[model samples]
Target: MVADAMELATRALLEANLGLAEQVITGDERIDDARSACEEQAYALLALQAPVATDLRTVLAAIHAAESLERMGDLALHVAKAARRRHPAPVLPEPVNRYFAEMGRVAVQLARRAEEVIRSQDVAAARAIEDADDEMDDLHRHLFTLIMNKEWEHGVASAVDVTLLGRFYERYADHAVSVAKRVVFVVTGRMPGTVSDDDL
Candidate 1:
């Protein structure tokens, strides 16, 4: 659902498709609900069972991952609102639109990867998401440079939109990284940076 929101937000921005933007805006509540359900279920499981070792880790990871995913959904919602606010005028202009589209694609990819890691608990795949986040960071820096460039003609408003939009995408990727790291913790019995898998 978070991935879908990111994709729709991108499509809405790139195509100036008002309907898609509306869908993203309206559908955010469903994401919130789903996130709530995940947290509630995880809590219920913890309350009912004295889970040991891997089981305890799995439940805890679910709670953390659900929170991260909810944050991702909120970031996507921000982008959709930005698109809707600037409808018909185009929130992104020309070449900058291409950069945002790339950002969008990477964000959606991260969200999907986070989902997969949560389900499969693949530590290798979780590490891959950490690497993927670097691309998002680079793209975010490029957005800042784009606005600072003297040749920029989109004016202050579009520049502001671009900055906020870039941040939204970058933060979405950050949350995905958090989710992946939680999966790593579940599998390795330690967070990614605290201890190496070989040491554990």
Candidate 2:
């Protein structure tokens, strides 16, 4: 169920990036519903089955993971709105568009990695997910530099729009990393050290 929820969130993000504004908003409801259901199931399992130690950790991690994925869905919607606001005019230049696409791809990969770690209980895969998130952060910083430098120079509104879009994409990837960290916590019971202190 957790895996399914993650997949749905990833799909919602992809749709948002593809310029389906209405669908992205509508899909957020489903993501919220799924998160609620997952929370209920986790609580029920704790109440009825009395999971202990590792089992308890698994349930708690699942709840956190669902929450993170839900936030990712919301961020994706925000990105869609920004995209819509800049409609008919390309906010991102070709190079920035390429970067945005790469960021989206990395976000999806992180989501899938989280799913795999959860389903397989593989701590190593979770670590790899964490490492991949570092790359996303680097790309995010690069995108920011491009926007701030007025690389596209579409004027103030377009620059702001692209900046916000880059921020949303970066945030989406961060949430995915959060899910991966939760997976690692579930398996190993330790929070990993930060790769860097940058907000992205």
Candidate 3:
């Protein structure tokens, strides 16, 4: 549901909808609760079943993925709060709004692809997620360039707010990529850094 939350947060920012921003903020509690419950269940299984090897790794990956998902929710909440903080005024300038809108769309796509990678254990999808994250990083850099340009007239306050929003979206994509990497690790039994193309 964090993907849905991210979409709502993006909608809130793009439209300057205070109601959607408030919903994203309040909806974070649900993500927190769900993460807690999933973690508790994972721990219970580990303790009760004494799972070994692949089973243990699967459980560990699930817990880690849940944490990543929760972090994604928190990042989405930050985006919503930034939007609400600006109220009717957009946190992003009109010229840069399209970049942010594209970033938001890419973020949601990464989340969806991450879900597919997790369920299918498709190494190609996992690798694709990392590639998608690179796109997000490029967008983040472009955002910084816009903010830091000498001709920028949005003022320091606007620049700071835009920077934070960019970071939130960038980090959100990072977490989604991390989730995909974890799935690869679980399926292949190779740690993230140790996994080569042949292994994937």
**What TM-score would every model get versus the actual structure?**
0.93, 0.82, 0.94
The per-prediction CA RMSD against the true structure, in angstroms, equals 4.3, 3.9, 3.8
**Candidate 2 TM-score, true structure as reference:** 0.82
Please tell me which model should have the higher TM-score, number 1 or number 2.
1
Reference-based lDDT, each prediction: 0.87, 0.69, 0.88
Candidate 2 off by > 4 Å? 1-19, 150-152, 191-200
Q: Write one digit per residue (lDDT tens) for candidate 3, span 29-147.
A: 99999999999999999999999887988899899899999999999999999989999988888888998898999999999999888889898889888888888888888988888
lDDT per residue as tens, model 2, 1-200: 32233334334333333435555656678888989999999999999999988889989988888887787778766765555555554446556667776777786677777777778878778778768988888988887787678455567775676677677667766777777777777778776566223374
Q: What's the CA error at residue 165 for candidate 3, in Å?
A: 0.6
Worst 10 residues of 2 by lDDT: 1-10
> Candidate 1 or 3, higher lDDT?
3
Error of 1 at 180 (Å): 0.5
